[model samples]
Target: MIDAAEHRVVDCDWHYQDSFTDIVEYMEEPWKTKYEKSNWDAAGVKQNLSSFFPTSTGDRQAYGKIEREHSNYPDKAETPDRVREGMEFLDVDQSIQISHLALAMGGVQTDDERTQAFAKAHIEYMLEEVLDPDDGVYGLAPLPYSDIETSLEILDRVENEPAIKGACFITAGANPPLGNRKYDPLYKRCEEIGYPVVFHTGGSGLDDYVRAGYQEMLETHTLGFLESNMSQLVSVTCQGVPEKFPDLDIVFMESGVTYVPGLISRLEEEYLKRPEEAPLLEKRPSEYITDYYFGTQPLEVSASPDLLELCFDMLGTDRLLYASDYPHWDFDSPSTITDLPFISDEERKAILAGNAVEVFDL
Candidate 1:
């Protein structure tokens, strides 16, 4: 049995690679042919996308090397050595890793072969490297949102796998809005299999945070979280997904909890004003919102201590989880959060591992 004290920390949000080549390996012959002929090279795509994030001064070259190596060894990111290193750095017992690039692959245009190739590659990588490991590392499987049948098929394949905790769908893109009935089948499958559905911010391709004509990476990264978090909330409420999948657990990743109170308040107010248009809910919108979970990181230190109390008061403590967002620039060190000011020691322990233990059934 895993000791709660020794194996207590569970990072709710960590990342893994989305190497195109790795994804392409599992593609059918036709898809592979299409991807090989595509104009956009994998390296170019990654470089262009990285420009939107804040990179360290000397890290650009190192990132280039890392990306290149990953492009070659698609499984490199999931290697045990790398996972262990990350766990040590964050002082966490286990990691629930989501892949931004892999999720993006689901949005790639399926009319062409490249899209098919991308899906096959991503699914194969998730199964072989990310989810098949016996180590403590856990994975969020990517779904091919472009094709619901395929997405459901993939879910069916991975849901029973012990290493896989849930399916990850991006907050934005060609994928249908979260509230659409089209997603009901997927949600139903998740509910049947007892796996959560996770929505991660970013990978919109067009950086919403990038100011027009302004190229500062820092500005883009900072503003990106705001846009992403708002979109996530909107997707859940405006799209009416919660009403459709009342039993399904949804996790909002990387987005902080500070905005949740205001969002839930607004949702409740709107529900009260327009009960005719929104008739599916059994309780107040805030009550439903409280049933969902939010993974926090780089927590707003100035206000989070008090905000933590506010969130528990409003959303309940079980609805909030801790995440380190490890290896990223804004990554929060585990030790730093171990003694967060204002929060009781018991609350801190719940955030660190107890909540995750219940959520993931770890």
Candidate 2:
């Protein structure tokens, strides 16, 4: 059995309830003025009107169907002090705070300039108010996927901040797929700056998944992360993204681990028969996959330990980073990995904090 007390924990996928109402002050003109004047409390408007991202009508916490200790202060991780308090409760040594409201950046339905403005404002707020690498609260700057130029500019702006670790790309509703040539400049810039690109999936964009016949949140929530990550996994590998940007570190978050083995096996089989289609890839699809890292949030605790052990062997234990996805109802705790009988003490330490320290350059 692993000694839980001695293990150092690092949460790679922590979230704060971000609201435009709070960051509105960070936003720039015309739109800022328009946002201030907009009646967010209007009747029939979605309860999450302060958010720039589309609001799904999923009843997560409504009417007390679900409950958390800090339910009232949903944005408990909004400040450095608050973030530390939450971390202390979970017994985490460090946390990389991902955006809650900013997760839907790819699904922002507006002009490119407006979308870019929101991205810039969000990063500015994070850097000024929340991000504190010294205090163990780090963050990723969200990028406007549709605007490559603006995305590059955001990278340049935050290049010097110790607390700003990487650039986050919202995977839902992302057009041109990540492997397309249009995204090369962004990928190249991230590699040059020695920052990993984190693809964080969101469940708010139900319409995107609705086309696949998922009407309820349970259906969409269960499969949304898998679908988006799987699509990008195939897209990135088939198009030789890893081949082109060899130094760039890529991470897929929120999706659970079980889908990986089956998907990679199928992808390899297809790639074997069609090598000509992907000229740049010198290795099999699964080989390039090993180079990328994945978060262990929603880690699928229900699966048998023996089955999970096979997954750990195939994917390599070092590639998995422990993520709590905290504040959200389904968040995992450090004990999830600490109590696992399959992983060795050394492997447990790596997943809890060691791998994150190397991955985020902490």
Candidates in order, TM-scores: namely 0.81, 0.93
Best-matching candidate per lDDT:
2
Report, for every candidate in turn, its global Cα lDDT versus the true structure: 0.64, 0.79
lDDT of 2 by residue, 1-362 (tens): 56545667889998866666666678899868766666544321234454455755365564466676744334232555667888888888788888777766656656747678777887888888888777888889888878888999999999888998888887877777878899899999999999999988876576456474556667777777788888888888889989999998999898878888989989888888888999999988898887788898898888988888888888878999999988777789888898888888899999888888898999
Candidate 1, superposed: residue stretches over 4 Å from native:
1-7, 34-80, 103-116, 130-133, 206-214
**Top TM-score model:** 2
**Candidate 1 has which clashing residue pairs, if any?**
23-121, 179-239
Regions of model 2 farther than 4 Å from truth: 3-5, 41-51, 71-79, 208-213
Among residues 3 or more apart in sequence or in different chains, the pairs in candidate 2 whose N, CA or C atoms overlap within 3 Å are: none
State the displacement of the C-alpha of residue 4, model 1, in Å, after optimal TM-score superposition.
Answer: 10
Model 2 poorest 10 in a row by lDDT? 41-50
lDDT of candidate 1 at residue 315, scale 0 to 100: 65
